[model samples]
Target: MKTYYKDFLIRDWQPGDRNPAAETISTVLAEYSIIFEPRGADIDVLEIETYYQETGGEFWVIEQEGKVVGTSGYYPVKRGEKSVEIRKMYLLPDVRGNGLGRYLLKELENAIANRGFQEIWIETASVLKEAVNLYERSGYQPTTGIETKRCDRIYIKKI
Candidate 1:
């Protein structure tokens, strides 16, 4: 509901938080899938856990009064490009429209840019108008390349 920015206390997601994060992700995915299918709709919990376990990717959680309201993460891409694919960006329903989404987007961009990534890419269903707008406003423009089987808007921002 309420939103504000503080120092982003982020680190690699631990094994203990994997299930909770997966639970949270499942809820969001189910909720959103009603309108637009997520890119990786067939992903299993074990696969999700393994991604966190193996990639050593950054999974950031936003805390307000010590409660996790939102999360964002990135995974490495192929060589030469040296890109990071932003994934699993979700904010609770009650936390929407209060500026937290924009805040989180900025945090992710800053984190990725600092890690020496050349650009960031994201895929979301076109039905998610808010997400498309957020990406555009955050300097991401529509891109030609999208690898999803489903129809999803693709956006990229140069770091």
Candidate 2:
């Protein structure tokens, strides 16, 4: 599915999107002093179909000027009943502070809920203050469990 937001376009991962999407995510992480672990935590960004689609999930990319600048995706997890964990949500420096992050998140929630998911979980680092605030403002409650080495906070929202 494709969604349009002003001059930006939100769409599913395509054949050539993997590298650019991974670079966008890596660049965003670097801005926060977080290392991008492509073969480790970020392997999904490299193998979208294997890790996301094969597990009954999806990965999306945001594009502007025909170039990818942001990425977000989710996959099924065993933490909660019919739950999916939101992962790899990163916005490039160019797209920051334009309300695009919130828009993408809302779209993710709607899509996940439409898929009959009962709960949505997010794991992120406190260094990303904007992300933490976004989750709180979006009604995601604080929770325990830091599965990723770079992440220190987890939040859950029931749909």
Compare the candidates by lDDT and give the number of the best one.
Answer: 2
- Runs in model 1 with CA error above 4 Å? 1-12, 34-53, 64-67
| Candidate 1 TM-score versus the reference | 0.77
Highest TM-score scorer: 2
Task: Pull out the clashing pairs in model 2.
Answer: none
Model 1, C-alpha of 5: deviation from truth (Å): 2.7
Question: Residue 77: error of model 1 in Å?
Answer: 1.0
> 1-159, model 1: which lDDT tens digit per residue?
123465333344555555555666666666767422323542523355555435645666555555555567776766327688787777667667877778778877777778788878887877667778898888888887777665468887787
Over 18-96, each residue of candidate 2 has an lDDT whose tens digit, in order, gives 8899889989989999999978989889999998999999899999999998999999999988999999999898788
lDDT of 1: 0.65
lDDT of model 2, residue 138: 92
Candidate 2, superposed: residue stretches over 4 Å from native: none
Clashes of 2: 0
Q: What lDDT does each candidate get?
A: 0.65, 0.92
Residue 62, candidate 1: how far off, in angstroms? 3.0
